[model samples]
Target: MSLTKIVPSKPIKLYCSIICPWAARTWIALTQANVEFEYIEIDLKNKPEWFLKEVNPGGKVPTLKYGDDYLIESAVTTEFVADLLPEAKLLPSDPFELAQSRLMADRFMEFVFPAFRKGLYQGDVAGLSAELFDGIEKFEPYLINAKPFFGGSDHPALAEILVAPFVSRLYLAIESGLVDSATSTKLATDPKYAYFNTWAKNLIASPGVVGTFDKTTNLEQIKERLAPK
Candidate 1:
């Protein structure tokens, strides 16, 4: 391996918060890509002065600093890292394949991201059925034969990395009883998403998605945030 590929003298610095779904994208991408980065956990409640001033003026987690380059935004950072480390093959190599995969991933974000966050942020069961089912309905037919992951295969794909963080959170909430059993039962029984639910159960049990998740505390924080005024 070339020195540039193998060794980054100054480790790529990642400023992130554990709770952020956006930050989790970069985290999963980095792991699957096998890149070495120095992580600086930023306290979202009380962001460091340096993090606020230098890393991200917008005060968001998932700010990437490689050498002098400061990259922000989860999608840009994940894709950029994938492209940079072609050996890892985290993204598609062929041009046509690349375009199609990117399109699907974009669609996943539209349905998956909003629905997951809606349920999580609300911390109530009232709209949970609609939120969970809508995302699955949109994503299921497209994943008719996902082998062991998104699209098809045993290993996780880009869309999985892009969407799994929030899925992980929803599972956490359900397991902790923060979300009602009705919501979980509705998800499991939704005809539009039977396969999707099957896939979700597998994913929630997977190491990559589940390992990064903190079910108990994360739910506590969300509950606190969503509590009535």
Candidate 2:
């Protein structure tokens, strides 16, 4: 298949941080769609004046500036980028598949993410690791029928793109001893989790997923965060 080359009126600019999972999702989708844009690194910790002005309402990362038009929120940004390339549709055409796919993303954000997100923030250290394993279990069965991907898709589908960043972080923590070895072990080895494990492997291998992620540095950061001072 020939690549689709778009002639934009001007280059699009993406304001994002490397570590933000939401930002990471947009980055992956953009890459998968073969869309080109200017990447503007934003220090989420220290918001720049220009960034604040650009994303005035949200002051958030993963903001897309196309010509003079601006968009916020990772999901919206991803959808906007997808629209740019009509040939590379991210969501499926089947209504049932689209709804189910969206449902999986919703499950991860509402149920799986919150369960572990607070634990990671609280510096529960151990709890942060444990909560993720619980979330993985919830995801495992759902992925049981997947073809090395979420929703049994043959390719790295939307759900994989959205969740890979967080999973990558946990996988790193496990290797560095920041997370419990047993939990990571279960996530990787448990038969019940075969679906997620295989799909995760594929997601981990995706160029888009790896391009924005820095596991080694992120591990060191998490370790420093949990260190007993």
Candidate 3:
């Protein structure tokens, strides 16, 4: 189903931080959709006082200031953009399909990511590798028919956009030896994950994902934060 793009008369402003995965969700969506909007980079460490006072009271990135209205939370902002720019085909128009796509994304965020963080930050490579493979396996069925993306779209949709950031981070961590090297090898060579690996490779290489991701900086930051004193 084709959706007509609704160009808002009011100016759109996105406040984001490059290192933040949540902020990356909105950034990737907007960039992929080719929507024109003002980009406001935020220093998460020392967020501007005005931002705290005038924008999101919680002082988080990925905040959307649309005209005089404000929107918070990554998922909300990403879906809102997808809705506003239907021409971008950011999401599926069919209700059931859209719901299914969202369900996949929700499951990844709720169950998969926490497991990833536990292994990455807590020095649990064995557990992390096992849990990651298990989590990744669950999503394989979703991509069983994917032609390199969710819903068989040529390009990414909302579901891919939502999870790209975390996937990028985790893959990077794995390649950098933060996770077990064997896990990365399995992702490439294992027949069990063939579908997922294909989709993940395409996602990481996609323009919206690669252009917005600063790999060198993020890896360094992760190393520094997780470095033992």
Compared with the true structure, all predictions reach lDDT values of 0.70, 0.69, 0.82
lDDT for each residue of candidate 3 in 80-196, tens digit (9 for 90 to 100) = 989887878898878887888888888787656865676556755567787877887776655534787777778889998999998888888888887667888997899987877
The local distance difference test score of model 2 is 0.69
Top candidate on lDDT is 3
Give the clashing pairs for model 2.
Answer: 146-152
lDDT per residue, candidate 2, 80-189, as tens digits? Answer: 77667656666666778777777777777765676456544455766765566577677554453467665555555565677777666655666666666786677678
Residue 153 CA error for candidate 3 (Å)?
A: 0.6
All candidates in order of TM-score, best leading: 3, 2, 1
How many residue-pair clashes does candidate 2 contain?
1
lDDT tens digits, residue span 7-66, model 1: 454568888778887898888777666667887888998988988787788999799888
> Which model is ahead, 1 or 3, in terms of lDDT?
3
Runs of candidate 3 with Cα error greater than 4 angstroms are: 1-8, 121-123
Worst 10 residues of 2 by lDDT: 114-123
The parts of candidate 1 lying over 4 Å away from their true place are 1-10, 189-192
lDDT of 3 at 205: 92
The collision pairs in model 1 are none
